[model samples]
Target: MAFRPLGRRAYGSIPHLPGSRTGPADRHLSPALARTLTQRARDARDHVVVLEKLDGSCVAAARVGDSLLALGREGQLAAHSANEARRLWATWVARHAERFLAVLRPGERVVGEWLALAHGTRYALPHEPFVAFDLMRDEARSPWREVTERLGNAGFVLPGLVHEGAPLAVEAVMERLGGAGFHGALDPVEGAVWRLERRDAQGVRVELLAKYVRPDKVDGSLLPENSGRPAHWNWRPEAPPPPPEMS
Candidate 1:
């Protein structure tokens, strides 16, 4: 499928700077183009899937020459800073470069999320790990399913998918968030993205995508509701509710 340029403002009004390759695999930092939430009702007869939204930042992994480059979502050279988390990620890629390359073709790029706490943030974890949720290739189509399989084979933990026909409502999403066995918190997120399988004008396979942020997180605050004020950032995991007793 041909790649259709995102709506002029769909990715924000930031003019494309020269020498910058804004391919789908590249991550940008346009707050104006934050992910939006979806209002589509779940179909009772169609399959629906739910995934745990990790509260980490974004990262991109690509095969650069004989090595791999791991970049932050904002297109920063992550290892330049004295951040220990960044160093750890760099080391991880170096150690696992061979495994990643087995699935990645030359010049291909893979997008993943990097979850870590910044300096002075109380939400810091003991270690830094990553989870890949998207992938892109240079010569071939974006094989998302293949990417997931490759990552799984490499022993990486990918997000889970729920398949059901029931419509996914905010309440349902919240319930999934509060369920047990997940590692992340249930704080308001930028929102979820819906991927639609379709072809573009060039007859190339592409995904019609949309993003939705929670009403509260829209303003860049972590508040549960948009209260028109800055709220404290909480990363502590909430205890799951107890199971109901037999009637």
Candidate 2:
């Protein structure tokens, strides 16, 4: 699997939007307030798709020769660091690697979330611990339907789809996350991830894939917690830079 790239913060503003504010970190916005409000680039779509933005470690798994290698955003972690979720994922990948290889072209990676023990529990999941989010081919994104169907057919639980229609405003999507899933079932979901489904001569790729997190029901830090044990290398979740922070 290929490493994930960063999505420079979504420069446009949405009222009450809590974007990627991190270490030194993504803390404040921009060098100056005026620049953030006027200069940052923002994307707006007529139709928006929002999936449950899960709280877990970013996982990338692939089939290498005869072994199934599980990786974090940074690099491969040892058996102990990988946790149960990742080990289970590696097994799943081993079982279905050939099935996925048959369909994927070249340079495509299966991006997902490993939720064995990251943040405290938020959702009621009793199925496979890891959930597939997207199929990435270099910088381009594949359509959501294609990614989920392929994995779902393999008897896996795909990420929950919240909204898939004309322009669900960012604020509204955030509002719904606090309550239930699409079917009105009470689920303590983290937040919603928004992406535009656009097709071109090349094919379908996820565009402006962005996230909106709920402070009340989500982990404040993006990184997974550690056991306070020291290691030679630290593990960090790899992701495209957050959409340019909306001023």
Candidate 3:
């Protein structure tokens, strides 16, 4: 069965910029607009919240009508009990999740990483599973503080909060991360997502976000430089010439 749709795009994605992309598959856009977006991000580097990009399968627990269903990216099922996370949420966190369900307004959902045995063990976890660095309230994201507080109240493991209150170079932030993973080990963290909160003097609000895929780990699975389109097909930036200026 289907559940609520996810966020339109990740932070710093080409569409996050001022202009726009034709579609997810092609993702064609003007180079000048792309550069402008990057420039704006650079200018707003003073205030940002960075969270460790957990390297695991994406999983979610959404309120599907009367049932709370666990899902993978693209609404894929977790292979019955075969999926470690399915069990983790369907059974382990099942009871605790009720507290969350009590408040959820039906269409809302929570998404997080499902660190199971499938992806190499960086945490050396003893038992069941883990879900952190989540997306709560359907497509809407809860701030770092609210996420932590809510998860803590529900007995879920807290995700890492590497940097806060500044916009810094991806390299600098990666250096600080230095092979850190969920349990604080000197291993690959994949990279980090910068969640910038911007507020104007007139009380207007905006947010600039981006995902910086680690240079060392440029798997198409998660790339800051690349992304999939509407058809969920991944695409790479090639050496083709640009379309004539948008006049």
Candidate 4:
């Protein structure tokens, strides 16, 4: 049987996030998730985690049966994508197939940012190109603590940890992230992501993710297609040095 990777859902923007372009379906948080956020605001130690929001294409490596497949955000097999970045992601996955297969169970997928191609925030990466943020098996995500340990143990780089307590105002989160994030983003840090988990009525855990993007952020400001220049890669193995400038 062929593998069927699940598509990652678009994360909703926190209500206070400025200049968010979220559609109607993604603008509102579920009542339970909202309560979690509210509780976090009252207590500094509510179950909330904040991480540096990376600006890169969302991709995943899924171990299906005996094969590992590279997938785009929509769960399409990336090897067949027309986009060069997605194709490159497939090659990266193949190169690291052994690690992915070793760490993933039959139906699990490691979803993360593929930073090989610059998007809004380009990086001078301090680690491998792919920064795994979540371990999912369909719609459910592993809890934050487990996610950190699992992905870290599996030798995957993770997004910079920003905060883990009360929800901070956007300005505060940016201040903590500073001009360049831990990954060495050349431009302004785009924003931060908030993740919270709570048990449902059936006692099944539900994970929620919300984001706060900078109000002035311009999507894809650095891509070749948008910038009309040669591509700037965040990670290119054996990348050649740039030519000397003419006087």
Candidate 5:
């Protein structure tokens, strides 16, 4: 259940992002994806859904057989992770295991942000700390509409919805979000994720996923390593739980 990295944005680049280079191989958007984001999608069935990108640790709850396991970015058992943030994330996952198990099917995973520790932006989160953005099976992602309906129905707080329907410019999307985002971010949002979807007789196809990170946004500004200060926490569990049992 190793996480697949979200493709880089076709637009602006974050200073710290390795893939934000101008090389040909670093072009994150495919031809179809580029077309869809700039102008109307070629097919009538195609549409775009953009979600506000959060500054937090990426985590997932994967269904392994009958049990749900909390995983870090590289698919390591998060409960055993050397990183404190991931360990805390595992505890949070355990406290809310039933919610993940209720929504995930066999071999499926709910990938999202773990905001217990702030990265660049600190949050006074209005909802749960874990905010799911994708319902995935291996490298394949579920359609945006399905992801929203399914995860939303199961009490998952997803990233803020910036826009839906026709292709929109980054400036336009930012204007729509105003200054702060939906999840109660204290500072300006990092950026937005763009998911392109198309429906046909075969069902919904998740064409491509891209993101736009603000050029001026500093990476890990709130983190202890970056700031040379104490760690900044967005949320914390009441008590640290025992290490989770793993298969």
Candidate 6:
């Protein structure tokens, strides 16, 4: 499919930054969040959710005044004038800036994971731009439902959301992963991250409670086997995982 950016603009009016703000250079990076899980692999009582893990690299879009910044997963400034990935990211931002700006107020920022065509089967995916998962925000409310609804109306594909019960266990998470056949799947994704939504002094926040992955389920043939790469590398899951004993 030909990739089209969303119709939203960046920030229309610059709003005051929340709390004591610092320059972008001094801003602290968001930490990796995980989810909590319970024990019992086959038990449906465990709280867990599943979504298709898109095969692509990470991209983040932030608006400061009239300027819009696109950053790669490594926190480097994305330069479309030089790299293919940055060029694609720039196209995506241009197309979706309007809607993105609408969802995010001025001064406030929304951090999401961008999945594009770079490696594996997704490389052939036309256009190569879309938001896979929402990570964090500085807004007053959880804009997930609103942002997703807007994206849907604008004909943009937002990442899927599944709401499982509360108090999830490890066995239950593994059961869902096994049933999902995560490893056998053709997509080159690691697994899902667990999250919890709550309200605090900072408004509504979705916390990255944990990350989960079943190594046995991954398709080893697709990856560089015996290439002396870091064997302990784990896929960043959208939802966090339960403890090891739970699995």
Candidate 2 per-residue lDDT over residues 18-108, each given as its tens digit? 3532223233333332222223323332335668766666776543344444556554531324254455555555556776676555546
The TM-score leader among the candidates is 5
lDDT tens readout by residue for model 3, 110-177: 66666542342244543234555654554556656666676656666655666776445556666877
Q: Which candidate's lDDT is highest?
A: 5
Local distance difference test, candidate 6: 0.43
Model 4, range 32-149, lDDT digits (tens) per residue? 5555653434343346777998999998888779989888877777877667778788888988899888888898888898999898887888888898988888666777777777
Using TM-score as the measure, name the better of candidate 3 and candidate 5.
5
What's the C-alpha lDDT at position 83 in model 6? Answer: 45
After TM-score superposition, the amount by which residue 137's alpha carbon in candidate 3 deviates from its true location, in angstroms, is 3.4
Better of 1 and 4 by lDDT: 4
Worst 10 residues of 5 by lDDT: 8-17
What order do you get sorting by lDDT, best first?
Answer: 5, 4, 2, 3, 1, 6
Which segments of candidate 3 are over 4 A away from where they belong? 1-47, 64-66, 77-89, 93-96, 102-105, 118-121, 126-128, 200-208, 218-247
Error of 5 at 28 (Å): 3.1
TM-score of each: 0.55, 0.62, 0.61, 0.81, 0.85, 0.53
lDDT of each: 0.44, 0.51, 0.50, 0.75, 0.77, 0.43
Query: Could you tell me the TM-score of candidate 6?
Result: 0.53
**Segments in model 6 whose C-alpha atoms lie over 4 Å from true places:** 1-35, 39-52, 80-83, 118-128, 138-143, 146-155, 169-185, 199-203, 216-247
lDDT string for model 5 (1-247, tens) is 4333222111122221222223333346655555576566776798888889888988888887778788776667787866778988887888788888889898888888989998989889998889998888877889988888999998899899988898877777777777788989899888787778888999988877777777687778888888999998889776755554565
Q: Candidate 5 has what TM-score?
A: 0.85
Number of clashes in every candidate structure? 15, 17, 10, 0, 0, 37
The alpha-carbon deviation from the true structure for residue 237 of candidate 5, after best TM-score superposition, in angstroms, is 2.0
Task: Name the regions of candidate 5 deviating beyond 4 angstroms.
Answer: 1-27, 30-32, 241-247
Q: RMSDs, each prediction?
A: 14.0, 10.6, 12.6, 6.6, 5.4, 14.2
